[model samples]
Target: MIEVKDVWKKYKIYQDKPVSFKERFLYKRKGVFQEKWVLQGISLSIEKGKMIGLIGRNGSGKSTLLKMMTKILQPDKGELKIIGRVSSLLELGAGFHMDFTGRENIFMNASLFGLSRKEINSKLQEIIRFAELDTFIDNPVRTYSSGMFMRLAFSIAIHVEPDILLIDEILAVGDNAFQKKCISKIEEFKEKGKTIVFVSHDNGIMERLCDELYWIHESKLVKKGKPEEVIRDYLDFLSGSEEQRLKNEVMQQENQQTSQIEVTEQNEEVNKKENKRWGNGAVEITNIAIRNPDNENKFIFTREQRLEVELTYKTTNLKVERPVFGVGIFKMDGTNCYGTNTYIDKVELEISEHGKVRYCIESLNLVQGDYYVDVACHHEDGTPYDYITKAANFSVHSKENDQGIAFLPHKWFFEKGGES
Candidate 1:
């Protein structure tokens, strides 16, 4: 088991305006400087073989916590216990020497990871093959690319055969192929019951890989739960933060005591800027909005709510046949949530090359999250001519607060035979 008991880490920050020369001299000593707590009374435990994720925004003490786990940093007030052999990939090439050749550095680093020379010799070919650095193994470490360095570092970490693994965002550094390989290799370790703790900002991977997650907020452990639940809370917090920031800036500009005339002129200019548009030369999309059954602009809704998407488009050029309009919803990662087009229905009509058209999507089943709609106009022959990636963005605002690719309303029925 791994346990953290009210672990707190503190660092002394020198005052920028230390008054006297004597004060400056005392600032170097702990008693004079201001103490800031990075991790404040955090306590948690992990059963053996469980996979955990530590996540937060930048400067949320994620790095500090990971370093403490690896014994690179000590907590000021609390206990952290580890019962197994641990291998960490917190920083790439942390113990490597730039002046040494790659082979020499690998041997040195592997030995530091608790691997003997005999074991490293047995696994040398496998590690080099995974790293794809056989040709450069004889070259000095300074000559390797960042990708090469990451590959070698990851290869070394995995080859150590640790009972518990600590990984930071190092896997995110490599190419897509290497990243996939890392995911696969980590899954293999999970199958063998090796405990792993990961730190990353990639929510997709975190959701899939971690059984549980720790959320750090404002220098404290604010929440902990399944990955999906923590991510939902984090995203909601981010949305509120952005909204507050915008409100603060607007308030500051409005309250400035000087130049009332200039402020009025600035307001007018802003309105004009908002009204200006690069009207699509071929087609125009106007009045795109989403609504619930009552026909009000709403983001919150039940899965069964009558959802509708409405659009009005005008064409500038002649249309020999009914031009197809495509509407699609996309996830944050660019995957299409769902889409439909008139062309799929084989609708045909003759309209003037330049004319107006209205499209409405009524009662479509949708999952929850922040989704943006993409719109495109094309010919019946399937040639895209005009399109807009961000026609509008909206949140589904699910009531159930579930985590998934899609939420389906399902039920199970239990029955017993009636004396057949």
Candidate 2:
């Protein structure tokens, strides 16, 4: 959680500032300095347990506001408050000691998170492997390239698992594959209810990852709302001349962002599983999440995209023998759109301990509408070990104007005056 009320920040650029008395006396001239406000009365509140994106152009005070969140820079005026252990990737040169080796820097950087020596020791290997610097772990930081430095830095920041994570366009320093891996890790963070604030120019990330977006313009809090809405307005501010040109370009890119991802409807964690959840004490469904086929976290999907459900569970019994997993998709109006189970698909599973199960639909030919899912872990005899009515709710959209509940593959034909 974070609160910045009427926060103001400024920087002084000194033209001819004299540091010593000797220079001042010899020059007999005063320093000419200019005061510039980087953030002006920037009041905003961020809730806990969701991802956030900060959007703006260069010198638009986006990074300045992010720095204030970490208390690295103080606001010249107004109130600033934050709660949680904070970790930041504000700039590449701020965290590591240039003379220290990569392995040594891991201990030093993570120590700042208030972790004990033993704690740091435990995560050292994981950090190095995630950064893919196993070969160069002992190399000095000064000898490393820019990508290697960022990989280590990003790896350390995430491993510490701070309640709040602040990233300021630092993910741009890696290869395409590594960048994708970094994004997937960030998605896992969001699902774990970590508060993340990212300053990025990647529209795809902003659209697909963030729950809310804040737009800063000219050192002021201009707008804050849903990601798609704010991103649309921010893009228009960029085009200036041909307003819709960039918007059309974004539209071609795809799903819930700017014009590209115009969500017709949305919901916020609507798990109405009160009386809907029931089962025996043998096994309990711990949690469930929705994602794209690429294993990326997602709530909004299109008719053409594949949907994957990740279900995690625990068992009181020594082992859940002959466990059958099932998924039932339904319309918001309580219409049972479809249902299926592992028993029907002839899949086998033996859950001896806590584990996760994955159910995938190669193609959901559903029309534009809001829908809910019911997940179950039961026996082959149609007995329910655990069943949730409204486990997760999501919406589907399409570029075509289809009216039915399911998107049907059809073609139109016309015969005018037997012309054919």
Candidate 3:
């Protein structure tokens, strides 16, 4: 469990190089520097046994907040209260000594995490096996590759058996198989009710493992909610440059006199009347609608029912030819169920003049669950013309006797004597 209230961290950036030693000796002062608040007034509370994800663009203060929670760095203002022992993998070989052998660094990191000699001795063989460092464990850690060092570091950190685990992007260093092993170990800890604070750019993994998510932007906590909503927002942010978004937000804040917000109680009611674009692009998609054979837009459906997607788009370019339309269905973990492009099918369409194009997909076989649709338009040679990563997202509800991400509508019969 962790609680942060009104937390702020300020860092000093040197503005200019200090003068020569003679000037400094005479001036008796340090170089000129300006303070930049990396994190400002960030507050959040985490419940025990909950896995939380911290997400944002680079320099958005995610790592700063993690360090504050782990007590590696103290906040300039506010209080941070963390319950239970915390094991952190903030960086590769965080507490390791380059001069020390791998075995020595293991003992050092273990002791730093409060593991006794007897306890580390008990798990040493298992740790070695997990790290797969066999004979190389005796070599100096400076000689190890980045991946090997990360593997050993993670192996020791997790073996500490802390109540709280703090992880940054260190998982990126491990190979896929080792990362899988690490995820399984994290799942094991989650089953036992340990707290985890994970920070990553991999939205797929975050959505799969995080119980909740926090989105940090412009030195502040912007949104905290269910993994799906938070991840969606984060993805939208990714579609744009962070610097431009921050600048726009600041300008809007400064000129708040003309800004307006329309509030409505029911989301469905609001969506029925309002058209909201998710991002900026060369082509804009509008009028997205899907329906069944009965033309009903709402309610649950049988797995064997038909599905459709229709949308209209306006192009910004005049000279566009062989414009290919792409559609992708993605799972919650950002995994693609299937994706297709009109270009792949060699459907040639010439758009000599910029105008509107209407696209439709009929009788799509979708299983029972929530799924998102990413639509894009591109040239035949794979150059992006215009597109929305997620044009429309919809949910599929089950009536009964439905399974998997889609319903196959199949009938099976077994013969007793090897006859069909």
Q: Name the top TM-score candidate.
A: 1
* Predicted candidate 3 versus true structure: per-residue lDDT over 1-420, tens digit per residue: 899999999999876546689766765556678899999999999999999999988899999999988888999999999999999989887899999988888888899888899999998888899899998999999999999988998898788899999999999989999999999999998999999999998887888999999999989999999988887766545533433564466558547634222222353244334542222234444334445566544223334456666555665556556677777778666778878877776666665333444444444466656677777777667776545555555555432325556556568887677646
Off by over 4 Å in 2: 19-21, 28-30, 241-420
Compute the lDDT of residue 144 as modeled in candidate 1.
85
Tell me the tens digit of each residue's lDDT in model 2 across 190-284: 88988999989887678889989989988888999998889778765654423245335434644444432121223112233346766674777
The clash count of every prediction, one per candidate, is 4, 3, 2
lDDT of each: 0.76, 0.83, 0.76
Summarize candidate 1's per-residue lDDT along 45-114 as a digit string, tens digits. Answer: 9888899999888888888998998899999999999988888888877888998977888799999988
Ranking by lDDT: 2, 1, 3
**Over 4 Å off in model 1, which ranges?**
15-33, 250-420
Global Cα lDDT for candidate 1: 0.76
Candidate 3 achieves a global lDDT of 0.76
